[model samples]
Target: MATCEADCDAAPVPLKIMPKDYVYSLLEDPQRILSPPTAVGETLGIRGSFEYFHYGCDGHQDAGWGCGYRTLQSAISWIIRRRDSSSVSVKDQHVPSIREIQQILVNIGDKGAGFEGSRDWIGTLEEFYVIDVLYQLPCRILHVKELGSAEALAQIRSYFEEYQGFIAVGGISDTASKAIIGYHCSAETGRVYLLIVDPHFASVPSCRQQLIDEGYVRWVPVDEFPAGTYNLCLILQP
Candidate 1:
């Protein structure tokens, strides 16, 4: 199986150009999901072999756009209807579950929709899913509005100001854990800068470290920050 880094960098494998007429059949048969376990010794002889090829070796490179199904619901339907009865194995390395696969498809679909002029749904979905999956929390209306506002610039700044500590900690959690922190400013340029710091996993410390490492230079403890202070300067771009 390809390591995360390798899959991220390699050129995406082209899915076997199956005939158009067979698309439905392929989706209907789980055995066709990829290479079957029994055919492990043979080259290109498994069910869903194409998917595994792309997922394991290509890091789901074509995840969001090329595949026929675009929405999460459609992807789930495809998985459940087609692969459930086939002898495909979920135990293999790099095999994505129904949820993971759907998420990937949703990301791609969402991106395509955005670039093709569906910014509202795309932005909302992006924010919604990121928070939902990462933090297991439903998005508040305020959060959604801020994310989609024409004043994205002001909102982002305000977010940093109000949640500087939370931003530093990366995210909220019942238990502390390390976080990968980053920030982007659309005002100067659409670039994201990553921070460096080793806060405890799922803990405030990890989030804090993530912010510091990512170039948040003005971070302070929540207790130390003034109660009414708001607005933060953007200083890093990546």
Candidate 2:
């Protein structure tokens, strides 16, 4: 595992283009609603990833419009660490910087008309651009329209069982999005909480540590998930 550093030292890895066989799977309320695992201090996350804040830049200042890139970068960094850690030392890992993220947006081809790369908007499809264009991994997009709390938790647990991690967007508000890199289940209350890397925060080098100190990843009730309508991006390796 790469040790946490002042710079979130996750070295960049060669972008692996996902094979054509790897495509996004859309599911609307999968019928499997099995009981979750014993909620005894269970938790999951990208081993060496850190929290990131999206702000400071002109167009990226708004939490609503900027969360798309922030959330996508969060997932990309996690995947990079998961893929590149084995070859580098704790100090040598390449963490994706804000500049890299903007470049990625530019490289994805179309940013839409009147697109100044700033104040532009993107949704689940744009999220796919980062996943499909920026990395080599098979991903599944779960279009959760009205999924029950129990069913959603079961599906999330099932995905973690099969993939490294997943990204969830929408459902919180009109435009709130975050990366679901980890989860925790409490045995005492039998409540399940997802450990997420929320992208809404003031831009600062201490953002990651601030999140950790604030217990941002604390277990949050799965049933109370904010998004009434959400998309779960199931990221997997080919």
Candidate 3:
């Protein structure tokens, strides 16, 4: 009864939609939500299912500094779902919240003190550490200084085909975080396309279609991508 009483007095953990609960969650399939408006090439996308996470989740105010965390949550959500596809129950496979992620870094010595409670931003490297420490999962990072690299694009397409999972992308000029769930290359015009699910949306629209109608979830050509060093975090599954 003492343990029960303590549990009752402790704060309640916010209920997060598990990977298997997409049926009950909002529309999150950005890749298939709306077809590309212009004529693009054949699209190759994630093999397994995943979810989209954005700002204001659990009532946390992380607008400017939480994009990477939200992107990481989406990417990690895919891995958890894939790993637990055969399992009977996935109630314990919780995606770490922003505060939990911050605390984990501090606890594991990955981040120094004063980082747990701060609203500091994180990048792809921090994402790698968090995924490694949390799930012991290995990740392949493609470090390139530009998005127009021919070899990098080839390898990224191959990654989607091989691993068939979501990729966390960072290093755009504005330093926003996004997920690359699908890729396309135009054979006629020799143009490159990417299906990006941005995590910087502060207010999730009341309707799922609004998210797509807006620029939050859409196809962007490589030429339109901001100029900066590009890094990709590819989570590999066994």
Candidate 4:
């Protein structure tokens, strides 16, 4: 999303498939590492599987503003590998890089195949457009006016229960964009927690456990989230 030196006019690069262990969902031991509150009642996570994408994963100079792109890339990877892919349809099968993503958006517009790259950072709304463009996939956007309210948390829980796909969560106070892959409810204290996978930083992980150790993927309390007005981009996979 920012400072990507990839050529926007060059041919699209196919997403490199990492080893199964490198993928986030395939990594075990998160249950062994977590120190969640004993007050939680139910815990839910993403249904199928997903791969992790981050700032420096693909050799881009994107450190500050590439979070939205990384988040969207991970979501697309999950859709491509989902179990119900018999019905899945997309303009392209392989994942696209930052340059390709910008190119696709420009092509769909009146840019006429001439897109000058900018340093603009994309948010959850831009992610929605990218999914619609590449996958022709319909998505849902949930606006949370209040960050930690029970009603908002309930809606998030419902989405996890029904869809079980990764969601991109952006907020007014949250400087970084995060993907919500799990949810928990504390019956005793009526508190809710979110299992978020952050796509920030430039760490080259040797294994998935490194990410967990560094807190790139973990459970965060909803109360700790930034002040209100969170936009959730939910990609609906077929």
Candidate 5:
């Protein structure tokens, strides 16, 4: 609903695949991990799987710190499209451009820490609440601290069961802040995966070209995600 004259140009460095050792380290507690789901959409009565969608890599002028914004764009666009569409056609749905998303962030007071865009970010949970209130969209934010991994997974599963859409997530990686879109889960296996649309890049144009050619959404196993606090934002009922 908002617009920006300037475009997001920040492109992330080429992504590095998560090493198996690192993933193993993160899952020191094997009890927290689950197997992958064997059931497909129809078999599970989920209607269908929601395919990955990117709101472009240069979200918020490709600012290095706008991962939160980019992540929000992906989740919000998916929810809106699903709410408005009569059929499952992710490709033909309307999605806000990068500039429009930036404008919405600004309108919701998400400008960075200093100088209006100085790499600061609105806290992930706070931003979810802002988006929920401003857009009149239903959102549920769950803190991992309050609900251990098992409980958290249960809550997230319930959300997807009801909404059948991806949610926004934030966590730590390489000791730095990161934001991503959580799109899939398997109750049978107790596993979840997310689309990591990293926002920090060395060359905006080149990185975006690479994403377009190879796809932007890189699925990462949640159990292997870095050690840090995580927030799950469930965009409810579209």
Candidate 6:
């Protein structure tokens, strides 16, 4: 037997640290995580219950049946009850009120607020929640992962390319990152819009220019695009 100077057990084995790319490559396709857009109406009604109740005022009620719920809390409850009732399916139709449409807008705003305030956002939590709700199914919320600068946009683009249909909402800024703006895209319409929380105050145009220059996005004048919805592509950097 050979006499060893050190005990084999005494030396600690080094743990392998995975490179970010290797870890990223291991991730499941982002598109697979999304519920098909066919479920949008239902998901909107469910997740946006709060909006149904709050924004679906008399003006909204006059506009549609979906406007019956007059408070966000009530709308949420209604959605929950509907889910439990087993009578309503995604295909089971119900006329929504104008108020319901208004609620949708409000809910989108609320979502933006939540995203901005969240301390940890890896994109997974929101994605899972949206998928589960849309599918009328449940799933485990996994570990959160943060996207680095410009990485978020890349992720969004990948998701869109794979799914071919879905909306993407993001906080975008110029190279400086100081002048930031939020954007929302409609997959079906292929339309993208610049959202301003405060219309009285506007983001610097230079910021938008910066995003274009960096090849993070392409800018189309509002007049040319005309804003309802249009097909578009993500212009990535070389």
Model 5 CA deviation exceeding 4 Å by range? 1-63, 85-115, 146-148, 172-216
lDDT by residue for model 2 over 146-189, one digit each (tens)? 43366666777776766646565655354666667555577777
lDDT pick, better of 2 and 4? 4
Residue 226 lDDT in model 2? 54
Clashing pairs in 5: 8-61, 8-62, 9-61, 9-62, 10-62, 11-201, 12-200, 12-201, 13-201, 113-120
Q: lDDT by residue for model 5 over 50-156, one digit each (tens)?
A: 32222233323545555565555545555544564566543343444444444455554545423243445534564454445434555666556422366675665
Give lDDT per model, in order: 0.25, 0.52, 0.73, 0.69, 0.44, 0.26
Each prediction's TM-score against the native? 0.22, 0.65, 0.84, 0.79, 0.54, 0.23
> For candidate 5, what is the TM-score?
0.54
Q: Which candidate, 1 or 5, has the higher lDDT?
A: 5
TM-score winner between candidates 1 and 6: 6
| Residue 214 accuracy (lDDT) in model 6 | 41
> How many pairs of residues in model 5 come into backbone collision?
10
**C-alpha RMSD of each candidate structure in angstroms:** 20.9, 12.0, 9.6, 7.2, 13.0, 21.0
lDDT (Cα, tens digit) per residue for candidate 1, span 162-182: 432112111112111111122
Candidate 4 vs. true structure, TM-score: 0.79
Runs in model 4 deviating more than 4 A are: 1-40, 83-92, 110-116
Deviation from native of the Cα of residue 191 in model 1, angstroms = 14
Whose TM-score is greatest here? Answer: 3
Q: Which is the winner by lDDT between candidate 3 and candidate 4?
A: 3
Point to the candidate with the largest lDDT: 3
> How would you encode candidate 3's per-residue C-alpha lDDT over 62-152 as one tens digit per residue?
9878999999888877877788566754546777788788876776676888998899988877787777766666778777777767777
> Per-residue lDDT of 132-174 in model 4, one digit per residue for the tens?
6655566777777776777777777887888887788888777
Residue 63, candidate 5: C-alpha displacement in angstroms: 4.5
